[model samples]
Target chain A: MFIADCQARLAFDLLAHTWNPVLLWTLRHGPARPADLRRRVGGISPKVLTETLRRLEHHGLVTHRRYREAPPRVEYELTALGRTLLPAIEALGDWAHTHGDDVLAAQDRAR
Target chain B: MFIADCQARLAFDLLAHTWNPVLLWTLRHGPARPADLRRRVGGISPKVLTETLRRLEHHGLVTHRRYREAPPRVEYELTALGRTLLPAIEALGDWAHTHGDDVLAAQDRAR
Candidate 1:
């Protein structure tokens, strides 16, 4: 077990935020405009999405590109550093896919 | 990316709590009495540790055994279901070990 201040806790802190991994996974497909991201990701408010993206960007997990088109299109994409986290996220996703029912059942038994 | 209500979100929810993963990891070594847990875990208030343990018990990730000898003792250990999450947690830990400095650098740059 890692100590409370171990560097590994940093990964937990990154994943602890409700939306960070979600947005990171969403951006894995390719660069996406904010509106497109909102649509694809679903249920997240524009404000929260923006905040999440800014947080990801601040951590250098993601980067944004502004296309100076007629209306100034902007898009977000994962950085190489950001791409490194995909396997970890996918591992958790795979676990959930297989055992989510078990967890739900456990929860049900508890209630 | 997974939809907001996807099963994968369950894993994220499990990990989102700051101390859940920490406690889970601690229990991975073996069963320990609550007091031993408090001493080894360090800095966690007794109340929060109890709450986190109960939450893990409720989720079927952990089980407790009570011994009625001497002063009476209870030991907590991870369930089979709980053990399944170790690899996923380890994956994140490994990632952090490798890339935590990068994240710190990014945060520093953002500042």
Candidate 2:
């Protein structure tokens, strides 16, 4: 259906980002403050990290909770929908591990 | 494993493209000549389609066979590894069709 195409496109687009894994891996264990997530997903700048989180939040893949304190504390966590994608991502990881050689060979053949 | 991460990253990166579905859908039914594929994947420019096919071929997701004739004929088809990805794409499509509401709800909550 048209809606299915939209959803498929969205998921494919979302998972395509280099930083997505960084963000998902961070949330895999549990929620964390933005600073900590930035640390965990090395090589990401504050601007890029903030943008990535915002996009994830926008897509409903992650939740941002802001604490009311002298200095605001914001944390990000995977929502139920995001959690559902974990299995797929993990499956992809498994496939990548088990079939990397084949993929590499295919890559060579195509080249 | 290290190889898995690389493959996972590659697959994720490859699937992220908007044109990937268009290309795969074309190849899903059967092998396609470049011109026909370009026509089928509406809204795509010839250059972009060429680039996409090149990338797919480079990644071993597509195989391009050049025919010697009056006019050069380059036909593209899904390789074995590329065919393996069809199920994932179809699964995502089914999930999107059935669970779009859920994903939209999650999006609303995150906003």
Candidate 3:
């Protein structure tokens, strides 16, 4: 049997990083060059974006592809396994949309 | 309409904390005292567990209750809204189960 704590903790660790889900969600549509990703995901620095992409690629969630040319074109896309996480991410988004206000309010009170 | 980027980012923020989901998942069964939580979620310090519980309560995901006994008793339980997060968290867990090895392997390669 899958250990609930270990399995669940694994998922938590995966989703716990700020940029991981955002990058994954950003690529939900399809592959894109770094320039396009930077444009699409505003507020992220190029350096940070590069690091996040590398992590994602390292995790097998995204692939790094290079197109040969004078100025080599490179792009990133979510792998099939990575695609499976879209729905899971969406479920989280749905929860946030429905109840994020309460959380914000609570945070406000705490502060 | 919920902006996909903003909505998705909100979810990421909520789930991005290492202990948030773990604490939330720990209370899946029912209410528990801090001692029980610390026991169930091994490796977490009492201080950190308390902090996590406070955050979850602040987020309106968990409720704090106190008993009117001699020493006084305090316990935590998931609210109705908090329970909603179970499936979402589970969805993430499912993804981890299927592909977490790939992520681990990739991390090892990067190391």
Candidate 4:
């Protein structure tokens, strides 16, 4: 049990990334095409956004559904597993809302 | 309001990283010296562990207090803001516990 818990913890760390919050938060608002995700998830480059989405989709945290329209739209949305992770994301947001100043202060002290 | 939220969201992204979870999880168990952290956070090299702890300390998520006796000792603990983020971490753990299988299945399908 302990070993399993440790491995689970490690897996969670593997999923944590610089762009994850943006990817998840953007999806939290609603489903979006890859291009739209690039725009909505500001500060992310096209390459990085593409890579992030692929990782998220690969992990089943996000699903990609393609449309056979003229330009070929690809929409990304959280799957049931992805949705299951929402509370963690939302909880993060709540932490930021409440303690952002302290975090900023700590950053300032470090500099 | 929206823009501030966006920046805050961005900052949160900046904080998320592969080693950050391990660092935080190590501290979650309790305060420890850098050496101890390296041991507890499996698969992390000393260099990465050192860098991660510095970043955590810089961000005020963790603090370092040094003692000068014999071999010397330094302890790291989460700040109030860091403690404030615990619920989110615990929530992530809870999410993994409940939905780990689905997440894994999603990963398998992607392959």
Better of 1 and 2 by DockQ: 1
Please give, for residues B10-84, the per-residue lDDT of candidate 2 as tens digits: 656666676775577568877888778766666678898888888887777788778999877778899877777
DockQ of predicted candidate 2: 0.40
After best superposition, candidate 1 residue B47: deviation in angstroms? 1.6
Winner of 1 and 3 under lDDT: 1
lDDT of 1 by residue, A55-102 (tens): 999989999999999988999999999999999999999999989999
Candidate 4 lDDT tens digits, A1-111: 113246456345534675765577678767888777766655678888888888888777887788999988889898777777766777777777777777677778778
Ranking by DockQ: 1, 3, 4, 2
Q: Sort by TM-score, best first: what order?
A: 1, 3, 4, 2
lDDT of 3 by residue, B1-111 (tens): 123357567667778887888778789999999988887777888888888888788777899889999899999999887898888888887888787777777678768
- Runs of candidate 2 with Cα error greater than 4 angstroms are A1-6, A69-71, A104-111, B1-6, B101-111
Error of 4 at A110 (Å): 1.7
Best by DockQ: 1
Q: Output the better candidate (2/3) by DockQ.
A: 3
Candidate 4 residue B11 Cα shift, in angstroms, is 5.5
**Cα lDDT of model 2 by residue, A1-111, tens digit:** 222245665666666676775577568888899888766666678998888888877777788788999788888898777777766666656666666678778677766
Whichever of 1 and 4 has more TM-score, that candidate is 1
Give all TM-scores, in the order shown.
Answer: 0.96, 0.79, 0.90, 0.83
lDDT of 4 by residue, B45-109 (tens): 77887888888878778888889988888898887667766677677777776777776777788
What is the alpha-carbon lDDT for the whole of candidate 4? 0.70
lDDT of 1 by residue, B8-110 (tens): 8889999888788888888888999999888877778999999999999988999999999999999999999999999999999899999999999999999
Q: How many residue pairs clash in model 2?
A: 0
Q: Where does candidate 2 clash, by residue pair?
A: none
Question: What DockQ was computed for model 3?
Answer: 0.57
